[model samples]
Target chain A: MSDLSVLYDAPGPKAKRNATIGSVVVGLALLAVLYVVYARLDEKGQWSWDLWGPLLDPSNEVFELVWQNLGTGLRNTLTGALVAITLSLLLGVVFGVARVMLGRWARIPVVGLIEILRGLPVIVMMFMAYQLLPALGVNYEPLPGPDAFWYMVVGLTLYNLAVFAEILRSGVNSLPKGQREAGLVIGLTPLQTMVMIQLPQAFRTMLPAIISQMVVVLKDTSLIMFLGQYPELLYQAKIIYQDLGNTLQTLVVVGIIFIAINFALSQLAVWVEKRMSRRSAGKSIDPIMATTAAPVKV
Target chain B: MNVIIDNFDLFFQGFLKTLGIGLICMVGSLILGTIIAAFRVSPVAPLRAVGTLYVNLIRNCPLTVVLFLIAFGLPTIGINQSYYFFGCSALIIYTASFVCEALRSGINAIPAGQAEAARAIGLGFTQNLRHVILPQAFRTAIPPTGSVIIAMFKNSAVLGVFGVSGDLLGNAIILTGSRGFDPVPVYLGIGFFFLMITIPAGLVLGYLERKAVILR
Candidate 1:
């Protein structure tokens, strides 16, 4: 038997009988629980088609009423995620390479910022960006729009910047020592070695993690709705619910949209991983294995 | 700082509520995660399918959406409760998938021989898991589990968005609005409280990880 199958014995006739009985019992229990839950929902009129009507028909007036708002919300969400992800990747590369070049003592400030930002909640940071920065007389305007949107972008960038730094640092360190040594032997400065030889390879090696963190940035845009009028998908859904009183239906649709986008991104990460391993003929270390050795920062 | 001291009761209550939600979700997610992990590795095909489906769906969805669903969806299904209840429920649901994945990784770390040895001694599946596999698996699982716990703690702050009162973030917002004080100092205090919770937990988990490595 393989590792996963070791505890699972090959079933003798009696063991097969027991296994069948156990399956039946478990199946019945599941059915019973589902039935109870369904009955409760039905009794509360939750199964009525009226609540789901607007969503089922694209031609409904309700859809028309909310369509513009939904578009705006979707646009803002994408903008926030894209901007933050791009900025963080840039920041991450710089700091990650710095952390590697500068020893522990020299990198104290960088390391401290990463640790603190990683520890702080993204929502709290957004709050600080939205209210505190303005109070402190900082321009607080990264983008020329609503303060909430910029706050979200800034907040998300900071947290993700730190996380990607650690990921990239580990990614760089995981590379063969000879890669750096070879660059130095060619008369390259440390910065040149990193810029020319190491950072590019580290990024390729860490693509799965970087992509997964992009998915995180996308999801975090939802938190901006908490800040007020920051019309992301979640905010749009909330607004629709406030207008239509179909809270469950609105949330379900919004959830489906999020799940679809995130699922697609996750699948892309996996596909890239498979393609990379195949191209390398399994020579490159499994990127997932490397990144997952640490607690996933997202 | 003056704002923090002057409204100490508000901050304390919020702190307690935040901790309460964190504790509740921690325990709830652990139990749910164990069940899901068990389902995932079960011999029954249907059970495994269910477990896989649950994780695939939940892990991809944002916690905000999940929280919104629970906060509003459950009311339609006749289980109306406070925003606090919905917040805790959402945290448990969202975090359980990560916890299950972590535990599954731990379970995978076990050598096949240990499971085989247990079965050779006539131990059944549950017995083998409890007596032979899980204890060893958990030693390796501690770090990821700690990360999930810390994540859940940070996520508890999202409860404020749904108008849940008495959470650290929520009260900070409330008090800032009510007292008409500069939000920077209030938020600074709030951030410190979160760092206090997360930093120690990180250190402890780091220690445990080093200790586990030594034992290995």
Candidate 2:
């Protein structure tokens, strides 16, 4: 008999019959659950066009306004995410390299900083930036974006930078010792070896991981809603639903947008991972460890 | 310092709530995640598809969106519960996706021969998984599952802002917003409490990771 999985052999005639029956039963159960959900929503008049028309109808004036607001909110969310991703990477590389290259005495404080940053929740950092910073006279006027934008960016950057740094550090550590020794043997200083040889390779190997972190940053920009006055997508969706009396529709739409964008980014990560593993073949590093090593504390 | 001392009761209560939520979600997600992991690895194609769909849809959407959907959307359909219940459900649902992936990976790491041997001995698929595979998989799965739970603890902080009061972040918000406490010490207190849990948990997880390494 042909083997399909270690867990099971290819089904014999009796087994195949049993499998088909199981499939039919499960399929019907799933369909029944969906029907129940649909019936409930229909009972509540949730299918009424008045609730969905503002989001779905192109000709409606409210539809135009809704789209425009959501568009602006999407733009702001992307702006914040883009800036945060950029800064997190730059800072991650700097601190990652420093942690590796610095003397033990110097590294201790850096370790402390990274641990604290990694430990705190992103929402806490966001609150500190949005509420605490202004109270302490840390003005945002010098920055180009709105105060809330900068706050969101800073909060995301602080948490993500620590995570990115840990990823890079682990990437560097996972490399063969020969690579580092050979650089030192060739008369390169440790810092030069790390900068010229090690860090670039770490970046290449860690690219998939870095991209995944970008998804986390993109998703986190939604938290700007709590900061007030920041018209990020979730916040704008709130405004839309509140104004239009379509809470369920607006959130579902926003959720779909988030799922679409983040799913694309996650797919990009998986694609990079496949390519990287192919290129390195036998020496492939585990990209999953790079992510799970330092938990993404969103 | 004065702000923290004055609001010690608030901080203490918040800490308990945060710990409570973390504990509840950890147990909930583990049980749910184990079931999903089984669905994923089952020989049934439809079951596998459902598992994959659930994991992907939940994992890609931000936890915040999940929270918003459950916290706001459920009430409209007459499934209204305490905000705390909604928050805990969202966290459990979101975190379970990651846990399922971790467990599936652990199962995949097992040698094919083991499962083949179980079936060669005339074991059914369920017995093969239960008696032969899963017991081994849990060991390999411990580290990643620990990381997921730790991340869940941090994520529980989000519930504080989503109308689930009495968590660490919620207390900080109250002190800063309505109580008019200085924002600096108030937030620092919150940060301190989070680190109190996360730092120690990280140490424990690290030790467990080393211990869990299969010698083979």
Candidate 3:
């Protein structure tokens, strides 16, 4: 059941020779592309020590300052993600349950809200919140951070709650009808059946997807830097690079950090999926990979 | 409301630009993504590794970082382009990873027996993929690819702040930041335009998904 063998026959002597040739050609091609990129950067004096020293050289005073700025930016990013993750999960469960369990009168509006939120871009929602919050007399000075921080949190939460709700709904929908029927026959109310049986099962089934969505939330926190005031990772990278004139190096560093965090989260999701599928004897539905899926992060 | 009415031309132009970017990137990503999918599924180990590395690296980094690398970092390396070009490139590159995944998943969904049957019929590797695997894969890939493209369109809104003028968000900024108009109406108008694109696209994709279901 090897994936490769499904596509073609296992190689004979001739096919093996051809595969070796193909591998060599592709390997050389990749190396050539890498070399060209390196050559171009080197030609532009991009390898200058002055540009790279602050980020790479620890003894320099600027190195410490740059790291501190990046550290603060990382903290701010995680804080915003943390708040949005918590709030969105809560809203997602409520709205997700409502969409499934509520009467038509209540569910339609919930459906409408989720659809509208899903349709609009997160940045637009953030800009709207940035403007609307102050107008609504929601003073920011008393809050823990700048006005843009709250704006970012609110906006991320709004969009993600819709996504999370849809994910949960899909999770529940994928379950066997027998689960709910059995609960009803056992003398449980619909709400009780949902809370006691379906909801917990959905949570377990959708945990991988929910975690991956958190990765999206973390990445989205960078968009708030566009608000021009929030000192998130990207914003702080901007400040450091502007001072050091090492835009490329600073961004590469920031990019690596983002990749590190997100890669860890994605691996966790894969691990959770594996464990859940094993525990359920391969019965879990992988909504994340399903076709016609919910609105996943861009 | 008055601001939206008065700046109708600007908004319209912005709307068109957003569509232009989305359409161009959608096509670009589809082509690139298909190529990457071929690489991933091909027998060559190096090609598969390259595809895996490219997908993982791009998918993990935020689109904003990708945009910054293209828009700002490229210039320092003497590869400057218009912000619009950079914006489109960033979107295409970022979106292609997800597109590749969607397509790869589609390819995987084809029953192993189908591929074996193709091989049994004396089809070569490329022939088996082109005639048998791909046709079925496209059917399954359509729904997820549509979702990815829709997400890409919404992502085009981020181009506004990156100095790509004449998109919906860019025009919204012109109204609020410079002309001193109300942000509420301006963003609302923009939101309406976005909804106009996404909702219809979603409905069509849903229809296609239903149609694509194999009776077997």
Return the candidate ranking by DockQ, descending: 3, 2, 1
Query: Per-residue lDDT tens digits of candidate 2, residues B1-216?
Result: 899998899999999899999999999999999999899888877888899999989987889889988887677667989999999999999999989988877887788888888889999989988998898888878877888888889999999998998999998988887988887888889899999988988888888877878987
- lDDT of every model, 2 decimals: 0.79, 0.84, 0.86
Worst 10 residues of 3 chain A by lDDT: A289-298
lDDT top scorer? 3
- Better candidate number, 1 or 2, judged by TM-score: 2
Can you give the lDDT of residue A113 in candidate 3?
A: 92
lDDT of 2 by residue, A158-189 (tens): 99999999888877876778888999999999
Backbone clash pairs for candidate 1 read none
- The fnat score for candidate 3 comes to 0.69
Which residue runs does candidate 2 get wrong by more than 4 Å?
A1-4, A135-137, A140-145, A281-289, A294-298
lDDT of 3 at A158: 92
Per-residue C-alpha lDDT of model 1 across residues A16-86, encoded as one tens digit per residue: 88878878888888899889878977887766777677766677777666767777777888988999999
Q: Taking the tens digit of each residue's C-alpha lDDT, what string does model 3 give over A1-298?
A: 2275789899999999999999999999989988888888889878888899999999877999999999999999999999999999999999999999989797889998999999888898898787767777776653235777888999999999998898888778878899999999999999999999898888888888888888889999999988747899999999999988889899999999999999998888888887887654124644345312555322
Residue B172 error for model 1, in Å?
1.3
Each candidate's B-chain TM-score, in sequence, is: 0.94, 0.96, 0.96
